[model samples]
Target chain A: MSIFLSILALVIILISAGLLFFLALPPKRRSRWGLRPIPAFSELVRVLGLSVEEGTRLHLTLGHAGITQPTSASALVGLQALERITAISSVSDRPPLATSGEGSLTLLSQSTLRAVYRLNNALDLYDPQRGRLTGVTPLSYAAGMLPIAYDENVSAHLIVGHYGLEIGLLCEAAVRNNAFTLAASDSLSAQAVLFATTKQPLIGEELFAIPAYLQTSPAHVASLRVQDLLRWGTVIALVLSAVLGVFGWL
Target chain B: MVMRSPVATAIAIGVGLIVLLGYLLPLPVLDPIRRLFLDWSIILAAVAGLVAILNLFKAHWRKISSSRERDYYSLFFILGFILTAALGLLFGPTDERVRPLIMSIQLPVEASLVGLLTITFVVSAVRLFALRRSWMSGIFLASTIVFLLAGSGVFLTSGTSQVIKEVLAALNILPAAGARGILLGIALGSVLTGLRVLLGMDRPYSE
Candidate 1:
């Protein structure tokens, strides 16, 4: 079983490497992959433009996760949203705010804001304060976000990462504030809360596709395609396993 | 644009490879090296946490002092932070006094927030159907209703039909199945993300 598992891992690695190489090729050589429209991301583009026109803040709220944990990937997705929103809204009168519940993520968000603003030649707009460590604990984090959600004149929010039921509190606040929110989380309970509360909720692994939707990066496309392919592969495996089980095969 | 520093990437890849190899091959030599890398990360994380606390202080101080956005509520934040820090420093983290002092405030606040979540969830679930008129939303509301009833004495009664009981039991399994699917997807995504970081295809840390 271990040997078979090792072989499976090797095969997946080789396939991923190959696909990434091919898909991430220069546009001159290979056409970019077309992604299906997610209503949340589609609505985000419209909301972002309106946010700028109205000069309202865009709050990018990340969850309580650092780079060391498994939920770090989800946190990175939130950071990607932060980077994208900051870059897009750099020209706006109000700069975007990135809030996180973890210290490392707070630092990373600040770094990300700085880099993107600099890349856009809007260094004057960059402030480390734009990236905030709102709170460390889950409930504290939600409570910390309340004032920002209620008082920051924020019109739009990109809430992503790993969160629990506490996210519902943030969502409720955003709703009462009449803010447009695009929320996603690695936690199942958070996802359920988001699904029920936020009009734009990215479910399950859909949280990881933020980069592809937000930016024009070949690397993002490559990884997304890898994910799509593997997801289908998993579906096939599950179906085959069920068939085997029905046939009394081990 | 992603590659800010190859040196950083190289360091990440080296440490990540060592850790990956230690997990995969279980070699004695790689194990300690992996442990050392993990220890370094933990130390760095702790320092980063300290930096976060300072950022929190700075942010609240600004809110208190800023002319336009003079949020007096920030004074409470400042006072609470100082008190917590002083207590933690004076008594150490595991001190009974410190734990109770923190927990006394934290537990109730958190519990109240969680209780508020129940209302928020109820409202959201009620609003969910209003916002989304799709079949998926219908199914979601139906399942939610079913589960609520099932958890109550509605489905588990002594006089309930065996078929109805079996149906409710099957419905209970559906959430577990759905949760598993979500978990599988997240796990795949995480692996891809970790692989990208390891292979230097994505430089989230730098870019």
Candidate 2:
């Protein structure tokens, strides 16, 4: 059982490493720019709504899992969601207060937000202290975020990436404040709660497709296409495995 | 002039081989090396954890000192952390009297917190249905209600119980696909990222 668990962990580690390489590598300049269609402009308006009419603080979490999360699909989706939130925050002058679990994600999220602030000339407005590197404990992260949610008078909350049941606590706290919430995750358990509790729950692949849907980034679109192919391949393999098992081939 | 970049590349290859070999082989030398790495990780975690405690103390101390809203909560937070750490460290963790004291405080407080959190979750779920009645939200809301109903085991103990179980089982089908595919993708991504770090393609860790 221990060996099986170890092997499973190793496989995830390897896969995450592969995707990081693709992200790190420079994209081909001429790669057809519009392969994946962006989500409709009207849909974006409807889905996102106006950024909290009062210009209140926005709350964003990168989830407990970091950039090197074992579940890359969710993290990829989370990165896209972060990009969208930061982009909008820049345009509206409503800086999003970000929190994170892991050290690596703290660094990546800082880069993502810094890029957004630089693009918008809001570099001077940026405060490094807000992007806190909270402890990795799920409940601890929740405990840290609770005070922020209360004190900041947050109007909207957007949480993305890989999560677990503890998300229930976070969402509950956010909702109690009557804040608009958008939650997403690759983990079924987390998604289950988000789906139950939030106004919108971006489940599974929806989280992965955020970049293409929101940013229209060609590399992200291509990555989503590859992801679809891989997903179908997995489905085929599962069917084959089940069939083999039933026929006593095992 | 300063030397050209080589440390990044060297560190990458060195760490990669060590990690890879650590997984592949279980030799005596490798065991000690793995133990050392693990110890280092623990040390790092301890240092990080201490920083978190300090930050929490500073933040909450201000809240209490300034008579801010929910200053009482900060008092509880500080006292809880301090007592928990103090009790465990001062007397060895295995002390008989300490065990019951820790468990007594932890069990009731943690239980109440968990229950409070769960109730908040249900309220949020209820609010989802009220706020957004769209098809997607409706589906999510429905799934949530079904899951909660099933979890409570309210439908058991009658001839119709089998039907209830089947319905609960059916709702879970889509999530299975979502979970499996995502996990496989994550696994593949992790390996590649680790490899890149090992091979010197990504240099965020460089000092």
Candidate maximizing lDDT? 1
Q: What's the DockQ of model 1?
A: 0.64
**Candidate 2 chain B: minimum summed lDDT over ten consecutive residues — where?**
B188-197
When only the first chain is scored, the TM-scores of the models are: 0.94, 0.73
The regions of model 1 sitting more than 4 angstroms off are A1-3, A28-32, B1-3
Tell me the DockQ of each model, to 2 decimals. 0.64, 0.24
Instruction: Tell me the whole-model lDDT of each prediction, alpha carbons only.
Output: 0.85, 0.62
TM-score of every model versus the real structure:
0.95, 0.69
Report the TM-score of candidate 2, chain B only: 0.66
User: DockQ score of candidate 2?
Assistant: 0.24
lDDT of 2 at A93: 47
